[model samples]
Target chain A: MDPANRPLSPHLQIYRPQITSVLSIVHRISGAGLGLGSLVLAYWLISVAAGPEPFDFAQHLVGSPGGILLLIGWTFGLLFHFCNGIRHLFWDAGYGYELSTTYVSGWVVIVVSVALTVGIWLSVLIAKGTP
Target chain B: MSGRTSLRRVRDLGTARDGVHHWWVQRLTAVALVPLSIWFVTSIILLAGSDHARVTAWISNPIVAVFLMLTLIAMFYHLKLGLQVVIEDYIHAKPTKVACLLLNNFGNTVLALSCIFSVLKVAV
Candidate 1:
């Protein structure tokens, strides 16, 4: 039997998308998003150190509507990855393996991430006196 | 030991020997990021709309500089580890996989250095 010709496992279409599976995939996606987002963050930091002109330019770009949208999306990605990562830590510790607990923890991660994102944004807007 | 031939032993034991170390470091970085990220996000929000001088001054604080440096290092390294796993899992072609992994490592190091350098510029 040729190793290169071996049949692969079942494709994603074969399995129903459960919360556990969906969250699992989203974790990886969010992690990747954060990876890219880190570059943006680094650029911002570098610009700040460079001086007012570059800092203002970077600020202007991020303050724009599209940039704000991307920032918001990245915020969600950060929170999701953060929350789900804690869940993963629990699993790493050999807990949360039961079927019911797994589903509960998945939902908990989603809810907590959403709540935290909203809370942070609300506070930010309020602090800016625009909320 | 079971009576396995030398060829069998060599075949079974592939080239990967440090996978557990990778996993451990990934987890260690993750735990470190939890606190660092909280501080980072809160600081960013608070510093929003502030002038460059104010932001620079904030980063100049000794505690702030130390935390920022730590965050930058951990965040980029974690990002590299996470992306490496992602690329390894999804990329099937051998040549492409090696290329992506190399790029991942190199790109992360550059980004990390750039950020850390920026921090030091302000802090010092």
Candidate 2:
């Protein structure tokens, strides 16, 4: 094959958005978010290890408005990635190939993930009177 | 240049035949992370309002420490693999791509090790 003249795959912008395609892109996006968010996890763990003052500072930071929003975003990203990842595992196992099943599963992933995210936040809010 | 064929020139540059290993490991880590992430998210949520002493004591538990370390390893490995794919997909420039890939690798290793060490320090 000629390297310079090789045909390119359709660029993302060229295609109309569909459930499968949208979710596919979301998987990558959320994966990237969670990957970066792992640093926050590291920060929390290290703060706890560092002891009370640092831990209190960490808590205060996390409790702040910006930090809370970021945490919510990460929470959704984690849940979406988790649910969609299971869908991917099913596809890898040679299931969920039919178009109808793919669409259904895609919606299911979204609804379930959102529900779980809301559930988690509500639980947090009710327990602590804040999120 | 005189005697070597075009195929010979592009041989190793094309496929390294190591993609399957990368793909397989990504899936393996994904599987491992399913339970690990669930355990972690749920634990953090439950620990939400707890003070520093409670949280530290929780991490210091033998079982909790082991799980935390495992979670860190699998989570970092999965993140590294995923980021490598994203970088390869979008970053076309060779030098920048190489630099990002290297940073992805070394940075992930440092992050994972430090997190693990933190857990150990607290647990002990």
Candidate 3:
């Protein structure tokens, strides 16, 4: 096959953005983010098992400003991936394939993810008596 | 005559026929993760600010320990599958893609094993 004669598909630069496409991309990104974030989870569990000294150190690190930011990002990542994964499951089940329904579900995933994340953090704050 | 080339016929019979298996397993793991993740997040939130002994005591519960193990396995397996797809899509180089895929598998296994081990240590 001649290189010059090879067929090329439309690239991202030339493709129009749509909600479904954007959500699909974000789902992949958030999945990757959560994969890395699992390390933090592992660290917390391991530290706890090690002893109180390490557990307190881990807690302090997690409660620090930088750690808080990382946790926030991970929280959103987890929630977004979870919501979108459910949407994908619906698609797999042969539902929500219509263009309108796809768009609606995409928005629903975004809204639900944000609401859940905020709700979780709000409860945490209330429980801590810091709100 | 069939409207197919000889090369196409042979190519269709190639060895890498496991795509469906991967897809199915990924979906299965994703479904398993739904409840496990909810359980995990809620447990963490409820345990927040609790002392080490308290947290360990929670983990020591057989029910909690079992769920924790399930979560670790399902989460990492799903994660590996997701990252495998990402790597396969973006990494065009053959050697690099294969290397990344291997690393993803091994790395996730190590991470999951260490997590499950910790949980068991605390629980047991």
Score every model by TM-score: 0.91, 0.91, 0.91
Candidate 3 DockQ vs. native: 0.73
lDDT of 3 by residue, A22-111 (tens): 998999989998888999899998998899999999998887778877887888899999999999999998998999888999999999
Query: Model 3: clashing residue pairs?
Result: none
Per candidate, the number of residue pairs that clash is 0, 0, 0
In model 2, the Cα lDDT at residue A43 comes to 92
lDDT by residue (B16-89, candidate 3, tens digit) is 45565678889999999999999898888888778888998999999999999999999999899889999999
lDDT of 1 by residue, A1-131 (tens): 89999988987999889999999999999999888888899899999989999999999988877887888899999999999999999999999999999999999999999999889878877778641
**Candidate 3 lDDT for residue A27:** 94
The predicted structure with the larger lDDT, 1 or 3, is 1
Residue range B1-21, candidate 2, lDDT tens digits: 133447756784436455756
Each candidate's lDDT (Cα)?
A: 0.90, 0.92, 0.89
Evaluated against the true structure, the overall lDDT of model 2 is 0.92
lDDT score of residue B46 within candidate 1: 86
Pitting candidate 2 against candidate 3, the one with the higher DockQ is: 3
TM-score of chain B of each: 0.87, 0.87, 0.86
Clashing pairs in 1: none
